[model samples]
Target: MAEDLVLDTAIRDWVLIPLSVVMVLIGVLRYFVSKLMRSSQSPDAKIIKEGQVIIRARNLRAGANFIPPKSFRARRAYFSNEENGLLFVPKGQAQNAQAQMFSDPNMAMDMMKKNLSMIIPQTLTFAWVNFFFSGFVAAKIPFPLTQRFRSMLQNGIDLSTVDVSYVSSRSWYFLNLFGLRGLFSLILGEENATDDTQRMMQMSGFGFDPSKSLGAEKDGLDIVQHEWALPKFEQRAEAVLKKLVS
Candidate 1:
């Protein structure tokens, strides 16, 4: 009887525990899959009655895929009274069918499937290794290290570089991925810069300073006014005019 009990206990520890772990792992995966599918099913657009303004999406496909709000950079008229006259136009061709790819559920699903195939196996391998030697992973990766990684993945760039340049008024139109405008747009509230200002800043990044680069005059306006012309030139002009009149 004692020998039988010892064998039973050893079998339970070696077999039962691992089996239970595998079952729990399967259950967690199922739950996540269901949740992700449900999230993908929801409508991408929702209108709320926040105030008097009735907001409508101008571009449906662009609106669906995390596209930034419409900017008024291009509509800038040479002589316009309106503030948004010198508006910024966001970059990229909104007319192209490819631009609307992200809005399609099938495309998003396909992309996600491909991404998961690339990520899941590696993540599971890491998790299994970590489970076998728990303290080793935790000790090697401190809280601060993980925090920095998360911050970078989410924010991408630091706020310290924001004030480095005076963004231009027009560059805000091309504020997509080509320009750092897309990254800066992720910041909230007051952190966001106007299209013109951001464009100026972008120009500044290219070693262009509109404020100081003007060559003494612009558009026929002499920046440096030479007050009180030479006395000789003034006398000569006056004498010539008097002789002509006489």
Candidate 2:
């Protein structure tokens, strides 16, 4: 068995502390960069108009049952009419099918700019730290971990006999990348786009999948799954009133 390797105070002060600070500063920097770039990149007007139409249609449908039949019918016609519906246009004026490849290019561009802001800072920071700070055991976890985690936890350190609980400088960079997002959020307001954590989470299974969202939305809109309420509501109200009277 190897001797217990103790971390020095200097290593903790220099490597561990600076790495965490750099992570925070970089996160702040990335947030500002994303905001600046996004401000310069105005969204396509057509796309905004389409988004507004979809949202308005969704809202109209959601509240349709609450309104009078005439109002509902008018709105329905506005949505489903073959002549002049918001959902449809004359075939001669219709957009080319190929142009709808990505239903929202603005979203795609936003994703790209946000990603570039995050990736560049992260890559440059990781490379800088790893080059300068490799081969140092920064700290140790209180809990014991298995051999499977050895490479992941102790990335830069190459001690075959060392315990897996010991964390290396290089591994700290990655751990910090996901961890400091909360700190970034606390310091920067919610609207600030500095933290990539949400984007990263979206990349995970729970977040937005462009392939699934628009197609699923279109499919959902087609079916609506809502039985038109006004058609049978009068009969339901009369039946309830008769029961109450009896």
TM-score of each: 0.19, 0.72
User: lDDT at 97 for candidate 2?
Assistant: 31
Off by over 4 Å in 1: 1-12, 15-17, 32-37, 40-99, 102-126, 129-246
Screening candidate 2 with a backbone cut-off below 3 angstroms (N, C-alpha, C), the clashing residue pairs are 31-194, 202-207
Task: Give per-residue CA lDDT, model 2, range 1-246, as digits (tens).
Answer: 556886789998899998898888887887887778874556556546666777777787677567776776777666766566666644443343324535656656767777787678878998999788999788888888899999899987878789888888898888898777677778998865643546545643324333233334344455554445566788999999999999
Residue 208 lDDT, candidate 2, scale 0-100: 35
Give one digit per residue, the lDDT tens place, for model 1 in 101-220. 334666457445534543564367445533442221011111223333433222322333222221211111112223434433453223333343444344334343221222111211
lDDT agreement with native, every candidate? 0.32, 0.71
Kindly give the stretch of ten consecutive residues in candidate 1 with the minimal lDDT sum. 46-55
Q: How far is candidate 2 from the true structure (C-alpha RMSD, Å)?
A: 6.4
lDDT of model number 2: 0.71
